[model samples]
Target chain A: MRRALGWTVVVLTALVLQSTVFAQIKLGGTKPELVYLVTIVLAFLEGPASGAVAGFGGGMAQDFLLNQPKGITALTLTLLGYGVGLLRQYVVTPSPILPVVLVGASTTVGVLFYGVVRFLLGFNPGALYLIKVAVLAGVYNAILTPLLFPPIRRVAKATRANKVFRW
Target chain B: MALRSRPRNTRLVVISLVMMSLLTITLDYRGGQSGPFEVAGRATVAVVGALQNGVSKVVRPIGAFFSGIAHVASLQSENNKLKRQVADLQRRTAERVSLERENQRLLALAHLEQTLQLHGVTATVIGESVGNFEWSITINRGSSSGVKVDTPVVTGNGLVGHVIEVTPTTSKVQLIIDPSSAVAARLSSSGETGLLTGQRGKDLTMDLISVGAKVFPNEPVVTSGYQGGLYPPDIPVGFVSHVYQAPNDLTKLISVRPAVDFSSLEFVLVVTGGSSG
Candidate 1:
């Protein structure tokens, strides 16, 4: 119950930040996906199952909260969370740069997945622009990882799931 | 034996989650906002909107501070340039005053007062669209404030967008620059009518102008307010920034730059009721 509440707060905060503050801070005409960052980081801290669940919830919140077609974010983030978690279980990296690298790579894949889904759904906005958004948003999310990861790590530790994973 | 079953359980969970996501996507696409998913979405938006409004107020100043720091050098140069322009403008103030009086006299003769007053609720923009593809803003005013769906929204300079969705306390405005947005417009000088559609970014394309019509850069474009049109006539839309020949050569393609800057929008007026003549 406490874990659910904590994740809820974290997701809500991420949604607010994505729409309000980060919305103003545009780089190359794209803003960082704070929700994506939170989802991926939580997944990395926990494991695949929890990660996928968080992604679905966060994505649903985003789909309903914003104006884009529903389910695109949810679908993208769900797969991303699950994939990242699975990868984390197999690959244990002690390198300090792992978080940054993971964030940058995952963000790119997640955005590209979203674009492809939108395109298949007949909402293509052109491939070049999609590529641009994916690459730039990935870099932006990576840059923000350091600032966001530590706090998220702390929160994840407070949750029982984090405790179960450590042993 | 329990450890082996754990992997199986994980697989089952992942498969079920993926299936659920697919089901959501299919339902949303088929049913649209009228579907059950939309009801859930609306509820979520309403609850989150209050939180966003509160947090936005607290964070705006800090955001401004950081933005100010980033743009200080460019702002300084722009400030000096504006100072020189202000001195030049002051020198012409007397001449402009006479022209303004003449313009008022012309307007009175034209009986433009019937289309001038727009009484509506003013709303603050509390948030922006969370998705990348959709260009929109969320405003504080809602149905309770007499802001109805499809009501025309405008800034002081020109049209911004119309309200697409409304809750009791908040509303979503689909900006004029969204690709799906289209406005019927007329050229102020020639009165040539055309369909003005939004492009990818800040640009708009005015199409269907007669091949014989003469168009020039900087011609003012305003809403047609044609019979049964959504917006009232004479609301400033934009100015023609470029003109091109259509591929068929039967019409001209004109590029327009919107008068209101979407990026810096803070407040907007919702035209509640008036003559859309």
Candidate 2:
């Protein structure tokens, strides 16, 4: 329970931090999908159940804050994170290369998912834009994974310490 | 086994959703746009707008702080500049105060135009819609201000958008640059007519124009008088930005940048009149 609460706080803090710099720090006028990234990270760390719940919460927060369709991002990211977690066997882990590869793959999957959803929903702006968002997001998040994973993993380890010590 | 099955099914569902969304877009747009999907889309739009408004409210104070810092940094050198500009601004304000009186006079002079004059109940722009949703702006004015949904709002340059919702004290106005807004427009130049449709970002798409539509950059676009509308004829809208005649397209695509910058927009005029007939 304490570990779960701690993850929740971490997620909220990350969101606030992400929103603060969104204006100045955007890659191409769109902020990096922080919620999507977090979902992927948590799924990797804690497996699908916690990740799905976290993803759902993140999506709801985004919807409440961003006003996209109520269930859109929530439904999308939740599935993405859960699906990626399910694919864990295909990737293998605790290695540096795995994180690096997963970041690119996850970023691509998330961006493509969002773009495809928006486009399908009759808001097709242009096809070229989806490509731009996917490429930039994939590259930027891939780079960020290396910088972010170790610290996040440490937090997960610390939180899980209590759980492991009892065993 | 059930736990494993649950996760596996979720993967199937996600992939199916991707295909569903893809199908929704393709079929919806092609099949005259889906009704429920449209309702869902509009709901999403409104939700996004409300969300943007909330975000802007939370973040506006931050913008003000940045502005204040910028103001202070520029103050030392801007002292002389401010002194001169302040005098000019004071004169302009006085002139504008009388101009307000003249504005009423002008409205009265054209009795035919009297039906079209704005009866704006003052509203503060509380927040903006998220992302590139520049086509709509949320205001502190609503039904209490007699701002009904679809009431046309204009700023200094021309038409901004229409009130899309009404609370007791707040409403959201969809801007002219949103891909969703399409206004009947005529070129102030040769009077060539077209529909000014908003595109993503800050630009607008002028449609229904032939491939050889004569257009000059910076020429004004205005709302043409439409039956059963609040906006009257010849209200200035925006300037032509670019003209592109795609080699394979039947109609040319023209870009129009709106006159009133929705980004910096503050006060607006919401006309009392809409279609009563």
Candidate 3:
């Protein structure tokens, strides 16, 4: 219950920041997806199950709270979370650059996945444009990862520690 | 057995979640705004909107302060330019009194008051759409404040968008820049009509215009408000920035720069009612 509450608060706060504050601060006509960053960080710390769950919650929050096709983001984030979490279990890296690299690559992949889904759904805005947005958003998310990763990591660790103590 | 069961359970959970996401997508795609999914979405918006309103109020001043600092050098030059313009305007005001009288007569003949006399409910912008492909905003007014879905929203300069969803205390506005948005527009100078549509991250394009029609750069574009149209007539939409021949050769393509600076919008007026003559 405490874990759920903590994730909920984190997701809600990220949603608010993404929509209200960061929405105004556009970089090259694109805004950073803070929720995506949080999800990726949480997944890296917690593992596959937590990653998938966090991605779903965060994606759903985005879908319901913002304007977009409802399930597209949820679907994209779920896959991304699971994939990243699975990868984390194999690669044991202590490098500070891991988060930045993983976030940039995942964000790009997630965006492309979203665009392809939208295309299949007959909402294609053009492949070139989608590629441009994906690349730009990936770069923006990467730039933001260093700032966001540490706190997210701390929160995930603290929550797990509490859970272990309870058990 | 316990370890094996744990892996199986994890796999089952992942599969279940994926299926649930697919189900949601199917339902949302089929049911649209009237579906059960929308109810959940609306509930979330209502709760988040209240929090957003408070946060926006607290953050706006800080944002403005930083923005002001960033533009300090440009602002000084702009201030001087405005001062010179004000002096020129003052000098022209005396000579333009008779022209204003003549213009008012023409405006009355044109029945301009019908468009100008709209009853508006002023609302503060609480949040912007968080998605990459969507251009929208959340306002702090809703059914409680006489705001309704489909009501036109405008800033002082020109049209912003229309309300798409309304909760008791908040509403969602689909901005003119969204690719899904389209407005029936007419040129102010030639009165040539066309369909104005948004191109994602690009200037608005006015299509279905006659190839031979004369269009000049900077000509104002206003809503045509054709019969059964969503918006009322003569609302300012944008200005023509470029005109080119369509690839089809049967029509002309016109680019419009929207009158509203969507990125900086803080407040907007919701046209609740009034006649459009």
Candidate 2: tens digits of C-alpha lDDT, residues B145-227: 68887788776567788876565556768877777777988888868778888766557888877777788998888888667
Error of 2 at A80 (Å): 1.5
Q: Where in model 2 is the C-alpha error above 4 Å?
A: A1-26, A57-70, A87-108, A136-167, B1-58, B64-116, B131-135, B165-170, B210-214, B230-232, B245-252, B266-269, B272-277
CA RMSD of each candidate after superposition: 6.2, 7.5, 6.5
Q: On residues B1-277, what C-alpha lDDT tens digit does candidate 1 reach at each position?
A: 7666765776687778778878888988889758888888878878777777887666665555554555557877656654554454344333543543443443344344345665566677888887676788888878888988799887677888888888889888898888778999999999999999877565899999998898878998998988788888888889999998856798888999998888777667777875534
| Candidate 3 positional error at A52, Å | 0.5
Could you tell which candidate, 1 or 2, scores higher by DockQ? 1
* Superposed Cα deviation of residue B145, candidate 3 (Å): 0.6
| Candidate structures ordered by lDDT, highest first | 1, 3, 2
Models ranked on DockQ: 1, 3, 2
Q: What are the lDDT figures for the candidates, one per model?
A: 0.80, 0.63, 0.79
Model 1's chain B yields a TM-score of 0.81
Candidate 1: lDDT of B185?
Answer: 96
TM-score of each: 0.88, 0.64, 0.88
* Candidate maximizing DockQ: 1
What is the per-candidate TM-score for chain B? 0.81, 0.63, 0.82
Runs off by more than 4 Å, candidate 1 = A162-167, B74-114, B246-249
